[model samples]
Target: MWADMAADTRIRRTGLLERYHATRNFLGLDSCVAASAKYSTEDRRPLTKDILFPALRQVIKTHPPLCVGLANESSSTAAFTRLHTIDLSRIVQFRDNDSLRDALESQLAEGFDTDADLPLWRIQVLGDNTVIFAIYHIIGDGLSTIAFHASLLRALRDVPAGDASPLVQTPNTILLSPPIEDVTSVRPSLSTIFDEVYRLFAPKYLSSDRKAWSGNPVPMGVNGSLRTNVRLMSFPAHEVTAFCTMCQTHRTTVTAAFYVLTVATLSRMLAGDPRYDAISSTVAISLRGAAGIPKDAICDYVSAHRTYPPADPRFSWPAAAHHAAKLRTQKSKARENIGMLRFLLGQYVPFFRSHLGRKRASGFVLSNLGRFDASAVEGTWNIVNTVFAQCDVVVGAAFKMNVVCDPTGALNIALTWGEHSIESDFVESFLSRFQDAFRGLLV
Candidate 1:
């Protein structure tokens, strides 16, 4: 089946080259998502390079478009001809949960010290029951990672005995031509959008440089990192549906409500001003609408848009639905600016591109992955849980929050912080306040 799949594969060039270049030089930030599971039964198993490698190879063959690389002007459609895997044979056990966490943290800090090779993903089997999977951010976002994992797990479980053919392979033929005219002059650059957003929405107290800059430094003290203390709290799946229903009734979206709640919470906590209105946040919007991009080209095709709430204390809950409506409008106008700024930055000040995790702009980040279907792949293997982390941004300010809602209504919130700056207590307080805000909205 593998041979059959490979025989039928064809690759094509895409226009992602420029975008990839811009992202590489500017963001300096890589996004990765990981999921792991532990099995109840322990069985001594030898490393089956054949099984693992062939399976992955089949995936690559089926999804040949993922193999494209960033070239000068055009992307090269080719298979990842050079790829390697590592075998960590040494098995280490932790006596306590703290030990397990410490070991994992140490490994992540050391393992991913540099930018990842694009389109390449890794899988590690610590023992018979434990496994770890990680992927490069450039190729996939948090939602995409979940989708990839679900598909891969399904293939592993259901593929026929000798079937070697790759799964559904798509071609990478999409190309986005940069506009001939300079759009930056007419539209707001990402930085401008962020500045406007901060000015319009962030709390007045937080507006003070001192209040916004009050966190510790990197590498943090003995208390681990701020990210370590961030906990996830989820409401029943019905709650999300109810929230969406409320949004619909108000002519808004669940996403908009989330933003409002987040802004309200931050305004109250960081600035001690509940009446504070407006807060800036970065939202990942898909760019597959570009003319020539292939529908199936597996890549990071999303761009960030800075969103802000209305500067009105009365803009709470249903009233804030108007803000969501406005977001749709502003986002459309910001598209040209988004592309132009990215292009200009890629051409000139390339190094100052990272937007999220950098120390300079660690203000706040929110990624809403709407809803995903995971029923087909769930429980086939024990999936302990999943976590998402953003690359550290360098310049302005950096803080990240990721929200993923699965089909079952399970909502997972992953928050990442700069070790030197944000306090774990602050993060916990934010989460608690967010829940309160949600409840208040519902009422």
Candidate 2:
């Protein structure tokens, strides 16, 4: 629906995290993070492409990162370049899938050419009420996906009339937001640097925490698999409310409780394995709050923290409390793995290569984008469901558990894992046990 407008300008060099994600894409390890929103009009108004096309144009205009592409993709000095133009026909599409899961999986399997002349993001429309916004990991993180929907929701309700511009004319001097490093110090303390260096270079036998169990070892062959298996499970609004109340009664948050639940479940499932004495996991923490970035900003301001919890057969409140406290402290610092990335600056590609045959770093990675109140604005439209999903990476966790709450307080959980990384039977048993154990808490 939109034609190409022309202008090319280098915005800035990729940050450490940006470069790492760019390299991951270049290596075909990860594809994209996406947010899907299902909306309905309060006044029973029909949402047409005429309304959506203009709304998307406004969204693209406001979010500067949406107008960028990566340059020098093969080099350490790769930078984000403002695209010469973005053709809406190429970036946006309509799908007739009957199920949201099918549409989401389809988008997840697709990848972006970061070095191309277009922005590293696209939108897929499902039926009339749903839109999936997908972007390369280098440009935005999970929370950034939610931010896009929030902005788009506002745009959809406020689309100006008689706006028939065939092209989004981005100004030549558009200034992208400064990367996280420019806003905060990512350099580690000398002791932190030393510990990381020792941890990375030291042999496993020399380490004191060798008992921590990550899942099966990562594949090392040139043909290491990148195909992903995904499962979706959700709890209705009432159940979600009940769950939250239970969490409050236990003096823990839902995220912390899930962490403990995951660790406890793995402990039971893998108890027969003599090699595992502890369960290690990673939590993705959004740094936007700590970095003073707004929720609506479309950028990557996040970090991850690794936790090693004892593999215990029992799920207890004390463990959840401890984990919750740990997360609070981590969020306050907001520099968990960012410093490590800075230390590995130019070696991201080699760093990922070095982990080919190693045991996966963690059993699972948990990322919660928290809740979005789609009805926050009493506009003509309301967002009913919001889903956040990620494509599993080759060198990372064995599986991923992603959480996001829709407008009606329903929790949408997406379970994803790389194909062949672990036995399907193991994951199936884990899910069964997890659901059984989680229900036990609410009762």
Candidate 3:
């Protein structure tokens, strides 16, 4: 129909944040949102392209953002153009491996060429039942990956089994929801402006008694291969429950507790290193719920809150509680980051380029996309486990820690860093100390 054709070829201007990601993409810092979905079947049959392609087709047809690719990526006037058709064979790949870990690290190193006619997303079907959905940050955020898997699982359970004759379909007529700026108001108050200004130019010594512990300086422009180091740790359902109960007992959240744990663990691990006295952490806050965006909708609805947790040698529940209060206060005035972005106007590209070879502002970034309820879907396929991760080699943190919980209350944590950003031995030691401290606290 004429309607479908209009939708297929339409182009929409990218919002401020969306354009900011586009600028990052242009610089080859290529960040992606990747998550895993493991399915179960009573019959124990191997999942094939025949079954998955149909469900994926359904997902593509339903999620309009999936049907788009970036246009004029290197320019300030960049936009998203709806592709007429995406070759399923090129976007959806299959591998006979069961290790989602290997798949995740491999996928992160591969960036999307939005200049091409294909959509800015892909899916990797690993072994029999694990599906890893990866999308460019310009189109979606971390929680967007959760919404994607949830949608795909439902489609898998509902789409009638049959031949995968038609792997691709013409773009549908549905339009993606308006960008976050259009839906919500973000006028920065005078106080917010003053606070941001102070944070930008304040003396480093005034805020801390010691040098900030941001790991390594950012590499100069897409330094070499994009390979990264990754580590995944999971807590069983019982342990997850205990961890939540422990946090509640301490009057803090799991996110705040983990932040304190990371800060304290670093302090103890690098006790005598004279180059650093404080650690800066950036926490990603999802604004979907606050912005009235649906869970299944794909959009970049995220803001950030930065905090410097107490580096007390004796890590206690009280430290975590104090950090939690700070977190609550920062989140209460969310979207200041977006408001700050507005000041950049058309300079996002140059602004990102300027960060190359500079000391990273934060040591690490933490993102927690809380529990995903698989119980809501009463269908044949069950989501057993999930993975969420990202890496930005150009201007990102020295390392990143991403957290998510599956429907069964199992906790999954991914620690990722650009290769060479930090010493391998130091990261390994930090992870070890982190795990040990986490376990010790739950006891």
Candidate 4:
């Protein structure tokens, strides 16, 4: 029931995710988010729109990124999906857990294109309790989706059932506009831009361990399809507690621990490769607070930390964690706000696209939302575990890892990459070794 947002008609500017996707898409890449949540018979709550759709729709109504209206044929983005109700109990029969996968598979197999629906969102209820919500990366991110789902659960409890209320409101705060201090698309005095120009024009003097598969791709063209698969590796409750305790003891955060873990794994992988002497990476940082973006807004305000570890022989595990803490602190305390500034400038110029290269992987990417507030969806409809994942990543980046620690202290990490770049078997093997490296550091 909100008034239409005021603005220019032709300027349908995309946000962080869409801009990132557009660059990647121009480079021939696409992405999506398939987040799954499980519940049981105890969750007597309703799964229909009447119970949760209003709040979800309210999020889209306010946030333009989450919408799919006619922006001319050039802007072919749909917002909602068809209301297809298929009873998995009767349609596709199966024996065990594969049944769940089968149900999800059949639904997606229905497919969609630019002419599908208004909002590119859908809900699938398997049997009874299990619910799978799929959204294109254009409309959501790992954190925003978490907030959206968490908000939906809260709305469910807040609005009584069978309440045919015409208005469904999302209580979460929203940021209607950017800050006044934003540069508004000016390059300012960024020497780093010149540094990149120097590097690009420089001779290929530094060897980048080509066999490491972390360089500018040779452009496999349309043949370069990015196939992604999510594997959930969880830490035991006790190990989870111990890991957090160790991070605290080391005066670092679990996010830093994850950074150290990924860096340590990279180091281990490149131990014998003399060409590779160092690595730099980025971790997604939320701008809801830093950039004043609202909590409920379905837009991308994530910044990056260009994490570069020191060349010390003894830096491992706990030591590496503290180093990560130091690097992170530098990123935050820096005189120049890289992400926030770029986001402000992004209003006029798309700079994130300039960053699409193998060089971006000098540190790879890492994201850690930590543990979600399970109490937000507690009691009958408690959210236990999450099958959160993303697809269509930039190739030659090695891999993209997202970390989430559920309420029970169970840490879940998902590593995704394009199969065209790295063999699936290699990822599994590397992940196996990464898990081993983590176990070695467990105190």
lDDT of each: 0.46, 0.80, 0.80, 0.51
Q: Report residue 412 deviation for candidate 1 (angstroms).
A: 1.2
In candidate 2, which residue pairs clash?
A: none
| Model 1: lDDT of residue 194 | 80
Report the error of model 4 at residue 429, Å.
Answer: 1.8
The alpha-carbon deviation from the true structure for residue 27 of candidate 2, after best TM-score superposition, in angstroms, is: 0.8
Q: Once model 4 is optimally superposed onto the true structure by TM-score, how far is the C-alpha of residue 207 displaced, in angstroms?
A: 7.6
lDDT of 4 by residue, 175-267 (tens): 323321242322324565655456556666643332232524423343445445455577776888887887787778777777766666667
Q: Write the per-residue lDDT of candidate 1 for residues 1-443, one digit (tens) a residue.
A: 22433332322222233244334332333223443323221233322433334444445545432343322221223122221221222111222232323333333332221224333454555544334455444445455555555555445555433433333223434222232122222354567668656854688666523234323333312222322223445666777778878888888777677766666667666564443344545555545443234333455555565654433323265655775776576545544544445434434333333222332333566667666554534334323344444434223234567676754566666565545556667877887877877767667
| Error at 413, model 2, angstroms | 0.4
Q: Report RMSD (Å) for each prediction in the order shown.
A: 8.4, 3.5, 2.9, 6.7
- As for lDDT, the candidate ahead, 3 or 4, is 3
Give me the displacement of residue 301 in model 3, in angstroms. Answer: 0.6
On a 0 to 1 TM-score scale, where does candidate 2 land against the true structure? 0.92
Tens-digit per-residue lDDT, 64-176, candidate 2: 88888877886877887776567777778777664777777777777778645778898888775788898998879998898899888888878864554446766566677
Superposition TM-score, candidate 3 onto the true structure:
0.93
> Which residues of candidate 4, in runs, are more than 4 Å off?
1-12, 15-17, 23-28, 41-115, 126-128, 160-189, 206-219, 294-296, 307-322, 326-363, 376-379, 394-396
Candidate 3 has an lDDT of 0.80
